[model samples]
Target chain A: MDLEDTLLMMPGPVPVAPRVLRAMSKPMINHRGAEFSAMYDDCCEILADVFQTKNDIFIISGSGSAGMEAAVGCTVGKDDVVVTLENGKFGERFKKIADRYGKVNPLENEWGYSFDLAEVEKKLEEGAKAVTLVHNETSAGIQNPAKEIGKLAKKHDALFIMDGVTTLGGDDVKVDEWGVDIAIVGSQKCLAAPPGLSMVSVSERAFEAMDEKGELPYYLDLKAYKKSGDKSQTPYTPAVPLFFGLQEALHIVKEEGMPARINRHATCAEAVRAAVAAMGIEMLPQLDEFSQYSNTVSAMKAPEGVTGNDIKKDMLARGITIAGGQDRLSGKIFRIGSMGNVQPKDIMLTIQELEVVLKKRGVISGLGAGVEAASEVLDSLL
Target chain B: MDLEDTLLMMPGPVPVAPRVLRAMSKPMINHRGAEFSAMYDDCCEILADVFQTKNDIFIISGSGSAGMEAAVGCTVGKDDVVVTLENGKFGERFKKIADRYGKVNPLENEWGYSFDLAEVEKKLEEGAKAVTLVHNETSAGIQNPAKEIGKLAKKHDALFIMDGVTTLGGDDVKVDEWGVDIAIVGSQKCLAAPPGLSMVSVSERAFEAMDEKGELPYYLDLKAYKKSGDKSQTPYTPAVPLFFGLQEALHIVKEEGMPARINRHATCAEAVRAAVAAMGIEMLPQLDEFSQYSNTVSAMKAPEGVTGNDIKKDMLARGITIAGGQDRLSGKIFRIGSMGNVQPKDIMLTIQELEVVLKKRGVISGLGAGVEAASEVLDSLL
Candidate 1:
C-alpha cells in the first residue's frame, strides 16, 4: 500500500489524487505523433496558467536540480560573473550549479534567515550576468524576497532566475511581474504530480542570451526542448507516463482555477501554524517584515525534552508521515508539508496526531485544543 | 486509446505491458525511507542481470541520450583526446557529446555501414584517453563490432564506453568480457518500461577515473548517485512512479529469466526478417561477417514504387504503427521494432499488416506468403 495506508504530510509529493494516478496507467503513444503533440500542447497551455507567465515554458525529463542546472549552465558563460543568493539548501545548490559555468559572487545567509536586498544589489552592481534565488526555501520554511530582488536585478540588467520548486502552483508567483527571466518548478512539489519532471519557463531575454553562450550540455539544452515543444514533441524520448500524470494534475488545477488553489494552500499553511501555536510551539524560520513564512511547508522547533525525530517517530507509529529537519537542523525541528492536494481534513488529522504525540509527553495543554484552533482557522477561511 | 488500440511497432519505445503501466499508478512515498530503499535495491539487482555485468548500476532520470552524455562527459576531461565511432544518428550523438567534454577524434562512417577496426586501432594508438562505440545503432538497425573495438581499446589502454541503448536486454552483450568500461541502457527500449529513465553500469576503471576529472555537471554527477544509491536513495528527487514501473518491468523480466527473454527477442527479429525477405525487400544494414544485424529493430529499404512514409501511413491507417527512417534515410527505409514485450502473435500481426499494405501496390505476390514465411520462422523457434 505504501503511502496510501499512511497520511503523507511531507512537502512535495504530498498525496496524489486517484484521477491523476489512473491517467498514468494509459498505454504509451508515439511521442513524435499527433496525439502526443496535442496532449503536450495542452500541458504547456495549462502550465502557462499556473506559472502565470507569457514566457515560453518547456518540460524536461529530469529533477528540479536538472532544471536549476539548465537555467544557469545554458546562459552563463565562463567569463561571466553570477550573483548566487543563498538562505537554504536549494539556494546553495544554485551557487553550486553556477560555479561550474561562471564566476560566482555569493550572498550567503544562515538557513531560515532573509537576504539583504541592498547587499544583493551591490553584487549585481559588480556587473553580474545572472542572479539566482529560491522563491520558496522549502528547507527553511521561508519565502525569499523575490519581488524586491528581481527589482534589483532589473535595475542592473542582470538576468533573474528563480527556483520556485514549492511555490509556483500553491502561491502567488507572478513570473513576468517579478521580472524572472527563468522560473523553474519541480512536478512533485506544488504541482502534485509524480517526481522526475521539471518545467522551466523562459523569458525573451533569457532565450536570446542562451544562444550567445554557445551549445549547452546535450540533454538539458532548453533550446532543443523549445524547438520540439513548438511541435508538441520532445527533442529526446520523454517519460511518457509521468507526462500523463502531470497533465491530469494540471487539468485539475485548471478546473479549480489558480486563485482558488493558491488560497487553499495559504489556508492550509495558516491552519498548521495556528495548531502549532495553540500547542505553544515556536516556528523555526525567523521572518522579517518584508520576508514571510512559506505557504507550502511549516518548520517548527522541537519542544523541550524531546527531539524532532521523537515527534516524527511518534507520528509515524500513528500512521502519519511528517518530515524531520534535514542536515544541520536535524532533531531540532519538525516539518509538516502543506502543499499539493492537501486538504483541511489532512491538516486536521495531522494536528490531531501531533496533539496525541505531544499530550503523551505533556508538551501540550490538553487534547482537542490544537484541533479546535485549526478548525477556527479553517472556519475563518470558509 | 493512444497506442492501446494500435500495435506499436516503433524502435526504442516498444509497447509496455499493462502490469508495468499499473505499477506506475501506485502512491508516492518517502524516497529516503526503507520502502523505497528496498524497491530501488531490487531494481538495481534485476537491472544488473539484464546488463549482464558485475559492475555497479545507477538509475538516473533522463533519456538514453542523457545516459550517453553521462558516460562520456563524466570521464573525459577538457584536455583529453577521445575517439568516437559513428555510423548512425545515435553514434553521431556520442561524438557530439564527447566533443563538449574533451577533444574528439571521430571515425565517421555512412549510416548502416560497419566500422574498420584497423583504422579505429590506429586512432587509439595515437594515445587517446577513451573510445566510444554505439553497440546498437537503432537508427540504421545495425549492431557494431563492440567486442573487436573493445579489444583494440584494451590494448591501447583506453577506457571503452558502449551505448547499448537497444541491445543490452534483447541481444547478447558481454560487457565485462568485451572489456567495456561503461555501458548505457534506456528504459523504453528492450526493457519495455517508460522512456524517461536511463540506467548506467560503471566499471572500476571508469569509477576511479571519474574523480580525476573533477566534479561533473551537478545533476548528471555519478559519484553523488553512487553515494545515495548505496542507501537505496537518489542524490536528488527521482521519478518515483517511473521507478515503480521499472521495478515491475524488471520483476517480470526476472520471472521470465533473462536468457529466455533474450532468445525471444532474437526469434522475433528473425521472424520479421524472414517475412520481409519473403516479400523481396532489402534490409537496410549491409552486415559483414564480423558485424551483425540489430536484434531489437529491423530497418528495410522502401520498395521502388512506395516511399517509407507511404508505407508508414498505410500501416497507421490500418492501426499498426511502424517507424520511417530518420534524418538522411527518411522516406527511403522503414523500421519495425522487435524489442520489449513483442510476442509471436505481435510479430505475426505486424507482418500480416505489412503484407496487406504492400500487396495493394503490386509489390508482393500475395498476402499469405509473408505470414507463411513468418509462421515457419516462429515454429522453428518454438
Candidate 2:
C-alpha cells in the first residue's frame, strides 16, 4: 500500500494531525533565541497541564526512554535502592534503567496482570530511595496501579516516578494528586506529536534528591535542564522542528480540553472491547481491581484458527497499519490504538476492517456483528 | 521580522533547504517496521560516507552535546585519565562531560586561541585513557589542531575523540585516516538538517575499550545503539520526522559529493574573510601553524565603536540573522555561517545587507566595499 493513503492503527507513532505535521516543516530558528524561548516556555506550560502537576517540567530531546533515563539517573545514586515494578515491556525498561544507577529491587508480575501491592510495600518498607512504575503498559494493553504504588512509596518516604508515556494526554493522570515526584510522557503517543521529544515533570522533593546526587550523566542531567529551563532554554540545541510540532499538538489538546479528551479515549477503548467481544475474541489483559484495560490501545488474543501476522498483513494490504504483539507474545495477539485524535468513527472503521480480514480467513461467523456491537457502544456514550 | 522572510546566517540552526523541510512533513511510520529499517540503514550508510570513515556509526537522538556525552562516557571509565583540551565553550563542555565519567586532566587556552600542543602531549605522556578535542570550535571560530592532537593520542595509546559538529559534512574530515577513535557531528550545523539528532562514528578501538567499561549512561549507551543499528533500529523510538529530514539532507550532500561540498564551504569561508578584510574588520581567532580559521563559520571582531549585539540586531531588522559572541566574548564579536547549502549568492546577499546596516549606523566609510571584494572571490572560484 502507498504511504499517502495508509491509516496508522498502531498504539504509538500514531497518526499526526495535519497542522502538527505542517508545523514540523517550518524553517529553523536559533534555539537560543527569544522566539525559541517563548515557544519552549509555552510548550512546557501546556505539558504541566497535561501532567496535572505544579512541579517543574522539562523537555528532553531524545525519545521516551530519555525521559525515563533523566527521571532515574538524576535522582537515584549508586548507594540508593530503587524499587522497580515490572509487568510488561515498558515496565521492564524502567527496571533496566533503574538497575544502571542504583541497586534495584524488582517486583514483577505476569504480563497483563496486576502487581502484588503487599510485596511492593514490603520492598519499599525495607528501604528505597525511589519507586518506578509504567502507568500504562502499551505492550500488554494494561494500566498498572500507579496511584497505589505512589501511595506506598510516599508512605515509605521514597520518591515515586511514573512512566505515563501512553496515558498522560489521553487520560486523567494527576501527577501532583497521586504524589508522583517525576512523571514522563512520550510525544508520539497520546499527544499525537512526532516521536523525538519527551517531557518530564519533576517535583521539588525530586529536585532536592537530585541536588544531593553526584556525577549524573552529562546529557540527561535534570539539574542542567532545570537551570536552563528557568530561562526557557535547553542545556544543548534542541530538535527545533519537533518542538514546533509538539507545541501545535499541545494547542490542539488545549482547545479540546482534558476532560473531553479523556472521555473520548475511554469511550473509544470501551467500543473496541465491545466489538472484540462480539467477534468472540478474548481480551489479552486479565486486569485485576487495581489494574484496568489500557485506554490508549486494545490487545486481544488471536482466535484458534487465525494467526496475528496473517490478519495484520491482510489489514495492511487493505491500507490500515496495525501492530502484532511484541516479544514473547508475537503472533499470539493483535493490538489496535485508540489514542491521540482517534475517535468513535475511526474505531468503527478499524473494527469494520478487522471483520473483513477475519471473514477472508473463515474466522468470522457474521460479517456485520463486530461493527454493530461497536456502533451500539459508540452511540450510547459518544 | 516574520519567519518566512528571515534568513538565518548563524553557525548552527542554519537555514534548511526546502526539500529537507518537506521531507519532515511526511506521515508517521512504525519505527519497528521494515520501511523505517530501510530508511534508517540508508541514513547511517550516507553518514559514514560524509564522516569519511568505514568505522561503525550510530545516530544519537539528541543534540551535538548528547553526541559528545556519548562519545566520552561510553569509553572513559571512572578510574581512567582523560586529557581534555579547552579553548572555548564547547571544549569546556567536553571537559565537564569527561569529568563526570573519568578523571579529567584539563589543558586550558584563551578563547579564540589554540591549545598548547606540548602541554597536551605532556598530559598524554603522563598517561591518558582518552584525548578529547573539538575539531572546530564554533564559538571561537577556530579549528583546533585535530590531526596533530590525534597523532599524539595514537602515539600515547590514548583514544582520540573529536567533536566534528561544525566540520564533518562541510569539510574533509577523514575519521579513519586521522586515527580518530570517535568523531561526533550535530545535524543542525553543517549537515543542514533540523536539530534533534547527532551522528557518531566509532572506531574498532573505541568499541573494544567500551566493552571493558561499566555503568555507562543508560540513554547515551553506544552499545545499545550498536545493537539496534545492526537491525536498522534505535534502542528506543527515534525522532521519526527528524530522521526523514536528515535522510533528505544527506541525499543532497551525496548528490553534490563531499569533495565538491568541502570545496564550496572552503571557498565561502575564504570569501567571507576577504569581504570582512576589505571593510577593515579584524578576524577573531589567533591561529597557529597547526590551527586554522574555521571553514564552516567565520568569527570577526566587532568594529571598535560597534557592539556585536548591535550588528546582530541591525541585521535581524533587515530580515537576516547572525550570531553574537557567547560567554566572555559577548558583544565583542559576531559570527556568520558558511555551512551546508549557504552558497556564494547567499553570502553575497548577506554582505550587501551588512553594508546597508553599517551605513545606517554611520560605521561604513565605503558602502558595498565588502560585497565588491566578496564578488571577486566568488567570480574567481565558483
How high is the lDDT of residue A336 in model 1? 94
lDDT scores of the candidates, listed in order: 0.90, 0.91
Compute each candidate's TM-score over C-alphas.
0.98, 0.98
Q: Looking at model 2, how many pairs of residues clash?
A: 0
Top-lDDT candidate index: 2
TM-score of chain A of 1: 0.97
Write model 2 residue lDDT over A1-382, tens digit each, in one string.
3647578889989999999999999989878889999999999888888999999999989999999999999999989999998888888898999998889998888878788789899999889999999999999899988889888988999999999999999998999999999999999999999999999999999999988996777888999998999999998899999999999999999999999899988888989999999989999898778999998999899888877888888898888889888887888989998999997778888999999999889888669999999999899555
Candidate 1 lDDT by residue in tens digits, B1-382: 5346778899967788999999999988888788888988999998888877899899998989888888988899889998999999998998999988999999999999998888899899888999999999999999899999989999999999999999987778888899889999999989899889999999989988898998688788888888998788889998999999999988888888888888999889989999999999999998777688888899999999899999999999999889999999999999999999888998999999999999987898788888999999898556
By summed lDDT, the worst window of 10 consecutive residues in model 1 chain B runs over: B1-10
User: Candidate 2: where is the Cα deviation over 4 Å?
Assistant: A1-3, A380-382, B1-3
* Candidate 1 off by > 4 Å: A1-3, B1-3
> How accurately is candidate 1 docked according to DockQ?
0.81
